[model samples]
Target: MRYLIVILALVMMAAPVYAVDPSEILKDPVLEKRARAISKGLRCVVCQNQSIDDSDAQLARDLRVLVRERLVAGDSDQAVVDYVVSRYGDFVLLRPPVKGATLVLWFGPVVIALIGIIGLVLFFRRQKKYAAEINRDIG
Candidate 1:
């Protein structure tokens, strides 16, 4: 009885996920695959962390619809992405171009990591020098 109750609760929780209409299936699976691939690379402007392909937000859904609309209209993959990027700026792309404006975003992490490593090396070297001084004093 307890197991049956738990299963029923799980089923109820899962039901809302199927709210997407049955007709949402793409007529051309190949085009749909390409559309999904492109959407996966574009960030959801409203939800910066989630890709448009992965986000459940209305804006993401609309962007997804736009992607499919362009694809079916005979736009090449690069053309589709370029259209979105032009409208939203390079920030919309998961991979931004390596350019002057985005230099910090591209290289900031490596620069910080190098600084941190240098700091650690200096600290250890200073600690060793202090230990040597203390040893000399004791002798």
Candidate 2:
């Protein structure tokens, strides 16, 4: 029983989690692949954290359909994405381009990490100086 449970756990862990429905799949393999790649970069407004490809939300389904519709109409991948972005704003993109107001979103984490590192360095220096004063007084 333990061995069976372990095997099941391993199988589950190895599987990729996605919410693509059989009905949603495009008939053409090439177009389907492109649609999937585009869907993976879109955020589901309802799910918030999950990409549209991994989200079961109705909005995600609509967006996926929209993506396919645009693809079918002969729009490039970037153009399809831009159309969605135009309708839903940049928030729909999981990785929005770092331009205009999004520049902060791209660099904010780095700035925060630098601040933390600077704070840590200052704290260690202060502790070392305090230790030296204590040894000087003791000696």
Candidate 3:
């Protein structure tokens, strides 16, 4: 029983995670593949941390439909993505372009890391100075 439970858990963990419903799938395999790829890169506004493809939010579903509609209407993959970005801003993309206001989004972590390193160096230097003072007083 324990082995069966462990196997079940492993299988569940290995399963691919997606929320694509049957009705959302396109008829053309090529289009469907492209749509899926695009969806995987779209951020769900309602669930800010989840991609539209993996989100079950109504907004994600709507975005998925919109993508399909654009594709069917002869929009290129990039055009469909651009359309969504235009309507919702760069935040709609999981990997937003490193331009404009999003330049902060791309570089904020690096800036933060540098700040942390500087702070640590200053803190250690202060601690060492205090230690030296204490040792001189003891001597």
Candidate 4:
């Protein structure tokens, strides 16, 4: 009975699939594959860190529909991304272009690392100075 209950629990825990409707598939499988690849690179605005293809948020669904619509309309993958970028700006892209306002976003970790190094140097210098003073007094 315990084994049966555990099996039932495991079955219940399976995620309910929200797959795109079968009729929505494009006649060209290649185009659909490209569309999916592009969608996976777009972040869902309503889900901070989840890709649009992975998120179930309303905005993700809307973006998925938009991607499919663009694919059916014969837009290139980049063109579809450019359209969304024009609408929502660079944040929608998983990898935003490194330019202008994004310079800091691209370089922030390096800047932080330099700052940490400088702080450590200064701290060590202060400690060494205090140690020298203590030794001088002891002598």
lDDT leader: 3
RMSD of candidate 1 to the truth, in angstroms, is 3.9
The list of candidate 4 runs beyond 4 A from truth reads 1-21, 115-139
Candidate 1 accuracy as TM-score: 0.69
lDDT of model 4 at position 128: 100
Q: Model 3 scores what on Cα lDDT?
A: 0.92
Q: Each candidate's TM vs. the true structure? A: 0.69, 0.71, 0.68, 0.63
Q: 1-139, model 4: which lDDT tens digit per residue?
A: 9999999999999976644545555678998788779888998898769888778787787788889899889888889999999988898999889998888988999999999999999999999999999999999
Clashes of 2: 0
lDDT-sorted candidate list, best first: 3, 2, 1, 4
RMSD in angstroms, candidate 2? 3.5
lDDT of 1 by residue, 18-126 (tens): 3123454468999888988898899999989878887878888888888888999999999999999999998899888899998998899999999999999999999
Runs off by more than 4 Å, candidate 2 = 5-18, 130-139
> What's the TM for model 4?
0.63
Q: Which candidate has the top score in TM-score?
A: 2
> What does candidate 2's lDDT look like per residue over 16-129, in tens digits?
856888888889999999999999999999988988898989999888988988898899999999898888898988987889898788899999999999999999999999
Clashes of each: 0, 0, 0, 0
lDDT of each: 0.87, 0.91, 0.92, 0.85
RMSD in Å for all candidates: 3.9, 3.5, 3.8, 4.3
Model 2 lDDT, full chain set: 0.91
Per-residue alpha-carbon lDDT of model 3 for 1-139, expressed as tens digits? 9999999999989968579889889999999999999999999999999998999999899999999989989999999999999889888888878887787888999999999999999999999999999999999
